[model samples]
Target chain A: MIQKGMSVIVKTVTKITLGFILLYAVYISLNGHTGPGGGFAGGVIVALSFVHIMLVFGKEMALKRLRSYVLRGLTCAGALIFLYAATVKFSGGCVPFGAFLEKSVSCRLFNSEITLPFCEMLIIGAGLFAIFVALVLLSKSDRYDSE
Target chain B: MIEIHLILLFMIAAAIVAVEARDLLSSVVAIGSVGIGLSLAFLILKAPDLAIMQLVVEIMSLVILVRATMRQDLPFSMSGRWVFNTFSTVLFMCVFLGAAYIALKNIPLGGGDFGIASGVYLREAIPATGAKNVVAAITSNYRLMDTLGEVAAIFTAVVGVMAIARRVGRPR
Candidate 1:
């Protein structure tokens, strides 16, 4: 169908737009330390890409391709990973969590001076996955009444 | 200075339009645009972290509101009389004038002593945390507890969502 072809074109354009947004989100997340963005901003940027994709391709397709359960698992896994890192740091005399990682050299991962990036990556990943799952679920449930 | 005023005016207009718009969806979009504008204003005020946070939170809130409101039929018209509109407009103007007066009278023109400690924190965070990003340093180190609490809050939100989405007497 000609309509189907138009939809395909629209989908392709949306995908390209989302790809660019994803790159910017990663850039913002990584550069958050020195600049204005961080895990939250980066995560939102990435989530917006999924939103665009869903809007263009339809929720059913997105649910099939992006798997709500997988996103839910990713959200939990990312949060657990971040919490584990914080807990380890907290138990290592880093009172409050990430203290050793922050004002001291004794808690550096791999004994390197660059643990913030790794920690940020964890936060960013967790935030992104959590937000994505929430959006997907909310969108899907809004339209179709799943009993 | 002129640009800031222009943007501020635009923000006010957009907000009013959002409140008065007949279409719920259009109002939501307008509110989202106002949020973006507010974020840009924060950025211009040299609060990048706050700007980013505001943007993200606003987007999330908008999505949630849109989803919730989509199932309901929103009223398209105001239910009050001309007197109500006039009174509201006068009250808004008075509030705006009061705020402008306070901002002009209390806030300083340049950087003040408030930023000195933050600067010191940034200087110390680099060698202390082995992190090149000062913002990261502040978030992960100096305010570690706050960040942890935020993470916990996010986790709680996830749990809440799952609880809401679960069906009654549904098998796990």
Candidate 2:
């Protein structure tokens, strides 16, 4: 039988690792427009972090941490957010809407650096949330089989 | 040139492994890896968007194939007559050689001044649409209807998955 103390240590390590991964995911998502990484890359990384957490701490624990309904809601919300953003442009008499969302800002949040386009954040969020939902569903199914 | 030759060698190795492997799961994984490697080559060749699309589609295909295979036993390999094998090899070689010749001779060397129009549009797309990613600009602006259709297809796929998962009986 596995010792309680060893399991605790493992759990602690896993939590730290997951925390770092989440931070990195956010960094990648935000900096995607200016670098090699973007929505898809960041989203995959986020999903991988969840997968790691699930593997380390059983599906039940992971599910408790990240509820299925919340994930589903986030997935739908992301898509809706993206569509809403597009529609906002569409209603402005802009032909082939979502045309003006990509402009580079003169100054971004941190200092005077040029900020990436606004739609990038929506794309990143949508992609990340979608993958998160898929991973949750897949992990839950695996858990169901195990049970 | 070296990368191309390396990719060709890798492709040949994957093909042989896929043919000779006894386990269907291993074969599928091997094919999937080959698809990933091919997509990597496409990225190295300056087609990042195509590479991303190829990777996503290939992974989805692999997932679907694995799920399907999980429902049944893999078929046993069958040996063919020597003449048939010979003919198949010859036909494959001829096709490969023909394709290689055409690719080497006809295809453009690089993207070649294709960014000018896109750059001009990029400058305007951001101010007009408020989106930052140029790719997103092209996707939602130049191809809004197409983007909508793609989203609809994805929604349909999600519904299909839900329906299949909710089915009463497991497939035999």
Candidate 3:
């Protein structure tokens, strides 16, 4: 497996910044309906963080941490979850295909009605990120004529 | 207006430099500068969402370009035919801009009609959706079909990238 990654400075910076980047992506997605960003922008950021890790720490490290199959699974699962969120009927009985979900059910911790759409964003972003990683890194086993 | 025009001029210069630079890395960085300028313009135009998206997308594209250039020794020299191609490009841009000007000359530019529409949206958006962010309110509530279509398009593009990458993965 390829072991070499970028220089130490990059790795250090990446280590420091990756978590914050991911958090910001979540913030963007969660604030989609209430703020500037929504699912697409947040998902791109989420994918970008993983891609950054892969770029800085090598594909092996990235793959070990987040396997190709796991990523593919996430993509499917996330899409399905997103679809569920889209099709699921609210209390008012309107299926929000355009991400018009509002949460009426009040929980103690999370009272935000925008939870479903946020959840959808999280899954989709993570899934898309994995997909991007798989695309660029190209696992050795994925090759048809393996050397 | 003057500030925006200045920013646009800077963007044009940056774009030219990006195209003219021979070093692959520097060219990519110059392109990034153009991206920054574009995002700045977007911010000036009061489109924070577009600005944010532009920056992220720019970085991603730069990363991909860096990777591709690293693997292959890309040719930098434009062939002798570049002059004609450049001329054609300039002609197209001029024609396009002229057409746009003619088309938009009659249509209202930030006038009474536009203000009224925005005023109505501002009045109705919050109470209807309980969203404080007007941009979010419009995207998620008002233009949800458009968002859905956009998501579908992105999904399709990702799927296509996967397929092409798969083909590239196989050894020749």
Please name the candidate that would achieve the greatest lDDT relative to the true structure: 3
- lDDT, candidate 1, A1-147, per-residue tens: 001123777877886777788788777776766666777677666666665556666555666777756766666665665666566566663545554356354355421122433444444444444454454455534435443
lDDT of each: 0.65, 0.55, 0.68
Candidate 3 structure quality by residue, lDDT tens digits, A38-64: 666777787788888877887668778
For model 2, residues B65-140, the per-residue Cα lDDT tens digits are 5542333333554775878888999999999999999888875554545466666776787676565656655665
Q: Which of candidates 2 and 3 reaches a greater TM-score?
A: 3
**Model 3 / residue B153 / CA error / Å:** 0.6
Worst 10 residues of 2 chain B by lDDT: B67-76
Q: By the lDDT metric, which is better: model 1 or model 3? A: 3
Single out the weakest 10-residue window by summed lDDT for candidate 1 chain B. B67-76
Q: Estimate each model's TM-score.
A: 0.69, 0.59, 0.78
DockQ of each: 0.34, 0.12, 0.36
Chain A TM-scores, all candidates?
Answer: 0.63, 0.60, 0.70
Tell me the tens digit of each residue's lDDT in model 3 across B21-93.
8777777888888898898999899988888888887877777666533333344457789889999999999
Decreasing TM-score order of the candidates: 3, 1, 2
Candidate 3: segments with Cα more than 4 A from true spot: A1-3, A7-13, A87-147, B69-71, B75-77, B80-91, B111-116, B167-172
